[model samples]
Target: MILTRRALIAGSAAATGLVYAPALLGQGKPRVVVIGGGAGGATVARYLAKDAAGALDVTLVEAEPAYATCFFSNLYLGGLRDFDSLVHGYDRLAAGNVTVINDLATAVDREARRVTLAGGQVLDYDRLVLSPGIDFVEDSVPGWSLAAAETMPHAYKGGAQTELLKRMIQAMPQGGVFAMVAPPNPYRCPPAPYERVCMIAHLLNQTNPTAKIIILDPKEKFSKQALFEEGWGKYYNDMIQWINPEFGGADVAVRPDSMEVVIEGEVQKVDCCNVIPAQVAGGIAAQAGLTDETGWAPVHPDSMKSRIDGNIWILGDSSAQGDMPKSAFSANSQAKVAAMAIRGELIGSRVFPAKYSNSCWSLIAPEDGVKLGASYEPSGDRIASVDSFISDTGEDAALRKLTYEESFGWYAGITADIFG
Candidate 1:
């Protein structure tokens, strides 16, 4: 059998004489395979490998050699942060005995308890944790597919497309229209599209005062509607425009090559367009047969264990946790609960109910930030919100600055929690 990337990493570790002890295999140690080393999977791997000590074998599979966080990506686009701030090193995870595999997962066989890599290698697992994150709903709009992403940068997942959008915005001529097509409900980062609009608008004001940005939102109300609208008014009053679902911004079709946004009955051609499509679980989760028609996997709330398979657990954007918005913070919070549950199960102990918390921050400007946060606990069959917080409308400058600082701190803490 061909060795997968993970097997190669493990083999390399063994070759380096990194304290390999096969004698420790049968001592209640359960092998756990994690798919997708993003916010959720990385955190789970770190915690499980560190806390479980020698009682758990942790392996992480990810196609990307390095991770670029979506959280502070807007700051990079806005020229407020550097690439170094958003990039993380996985040395801490390696130090915790977590084997990292840089490869794509092609298939997952639940019955055989094995994950197949694209290079035709199978990895068996005692417990499987999946946090592959979201995938675009290709058919959400006409003529919109992964190929379309090259021209009309979604920038939702914050990678190459993000830089593309920023470059396009910088090159746009004055008086040009920069259009943004927001996705429907239950998508990753509800405030993201709005935040992108704000950041782009900020740049436009400095370079091209006559340039306009139109937000075509499907939802009548957004995550932080009042605050975002207020920021737009205070910063760039006449330059920014928003059309809610009631006003024909709801239904949209895109032509990536032409850079046109069709809303209601009219097609509006623009210099730059961002179409953030509806999202579903990443491809690996769907291939594993863990997800249903809803594009998400149903899991036991307390344990994050898949309803379809006993030993498989799904986390982050792939798992359908009731009332949880698909945010990086939520993923980080869920990782802890899932790790604890897995630890409990491995020790033959009853897994207790889980609790989670999440806070999402949107930067409107260098000095302005808006946020919505909530804490929740498992209730009967769903996660119930216990308390919440939001940046108050019309706050003082000091408070706004405080919120901005808090947002930076959150980005640092969460990234550390995941990669460190």
Candidate 2:
């Protein structure tokens, strides 16, 4: 199906449940089944497990034993941060009365309000919180499939592919070309591709000064454009090239064996390629009938309850949250709102006004970083940005250092909020 941005927005509004004006809070505990233990899901699990006490029964289902964050993945590639730093354990959630199930969820039955796992175990819940994050649409790019990913690592989700991409960079010969094909809009971490370029350039400048990096972006503008350009000009003037979609950089098809990308009928060969394909809600969400043609679930802004299934709440990158960018920070914030709404609903209470915020930081170098942040609130039918902040584009040695420091602090605080 051809997924347009407008269709996703309109579908979200229609699916949301009508507000019932809460009555006296009930006393019976409600069971919550949360899928995907990443940023948003982990945060919701932690909060519900911590505060629910005897009021809510929380279970978290994650396909992985541990989570590796994508926020500071560039630092890992640059050898600035160890993989251990980005790794988070789920013991805290378990301690807080959350049943942490490290297994794959095969299907979600909206009618039965149950989740079926690969092992044949079925989990029933009073409220379902889904934050499974994103999955690439393989058909979005011709010639790109699961097999092709072996040669061209997306590395957008920061797992094995991230390690593979790092090794590819290390193994490339000096003066080789490293090509990156960035995805279109509404993907996770809008500035991530640019951040990857900056980090890669930093590594090349140190070891292989003659090597060059190229970015083929599908969008005319990117997040933190001025800051990224300013840093590139100041540090790696002739080492990097950026081709916008209008100028023929939007290439989706990849010949993995040849390391070639077809852009507007022209094929270009490269030594190393990082292909980030277009994304949509994860398979579970889509399979559950929560998603429409646009590959995103619509939810009530105040409650985060799915429009298609009133008992289910969608959070993080899977939900069409109006103007909000799909970032870890935004997901974390939305989880809190969803948690509160769920708590109120299970106990016959009135839902209150919801407020959300997010901040995204991109490191240009080991010691240099830039950031963008915004605050959001629910409007008539969608969430609207109310305020925003961004770091200055120019490179100031001291300010850049401070930015990196702040980035570290944000990471620490967020992980703690989700797991501690």
Highest lDDT model number: 2
Error of 1 at 136 (Å): 0.8
lDDT of 2: 0.83
Error of 2 at 340 (Å): 0.4
* TM-scores of all predicted structures: 0.93, 0.91
Span of 10 residues, lowest total lDDT, candidate 1: 16-25
Model 2 earns a TM-score of 0.91
**Which residue pairs in model 2 clash with each other?**
15-307, 16-307, 26-347
- Backbone clashes, candidate 1: 0
5: Cα error in model 2, Å: 47
